[model samples]
Target: MKRVTGIGGIFFKSADPKALGAWYRDHLGLDVTDWGGAIFEWGGADSAKGMTIWSPFKQDTTYMAPSTSSFMLNFRVADLDGLLATLRAEGCNVVGEPQTSEQGKFGWVLDPEGNKVELWEPPAGE
Candidate 1:
């Protein structure tokens, strides 16, 4: 039951997500995409390790709800279902039901300090 393998993404609330992304793109040289996020490939774009995402959302967004934190951390996991079940059994505050998309399985849990933590299991062969 390996838990957090590595950081999957970093999401934060911003007054102006586009502007902030642009700033990072211009100043920090991040390859901010049209959707206002950047992906950093580890090893390479086709690496088995996958990439990490950096995105910002609107300040009023409820994506990080149930927690008053300004940012949420997304962690890469080998087994989302198993890890989530283990977390729940360990008395961790597992959030909503898991979801699936092209990006793979996703789940969340609140940290002791109440920060929203995202768990991501990349699609097979990703």
Candidate 2:
């Protein structure tokens, strides 16, 4: 079974999310939105249509709990449930149950280094 296909997003903590976002917007021209992030559309002859998100959370955010790392990597997966099951069978530290929203289906797991990893199955046709 195919595991991770590509990176879905990159998230990190910041002392001042707004300031950091503005810096990216002004200096890096990231088109940071009011939500303090930007979506990068990508399509190549050898790749599937997709987008990558770049965001920064407040330093105190508890989203990456169980991980002391300051960053989280979101991976794009073709089959979230299947891949998660395989990870569990392989003794990976699968986190909470998977969740689905308009955006897509999401699952969490911890890598060997204890970094929180997010697995995402983008909404159909996305």
Q: Best candidate, TM-score-wise?
A: 2
The residue pairs in collision within model 2 are: none
For model 1, how does the per-residue alpha-carbon lDDT over 1-126 read when each residue is reduced to its tens digit? 998766666666667778766644543346899888887657756556556677789999999988898888776778999988877777778899999999899999886567777889989987
Least accurate stretch of 10 residues (summed lDDT) in model 1? 20-29
The per-prediction CA RMSD against the true structure, in angstroms, equals: 12.9, 13.1
Model 1 gets an lDDT of: 0.77
Q: For model 2, what is the C-alpha lDDT against the true structure?
A: 0.77
What is the TM-score of each predicted model, taking all chains together? 0.64, 0.65
Task: Please list the C-alpha lDDT of all candidates, in the order they appear.
Answer: 0.77, 0.77
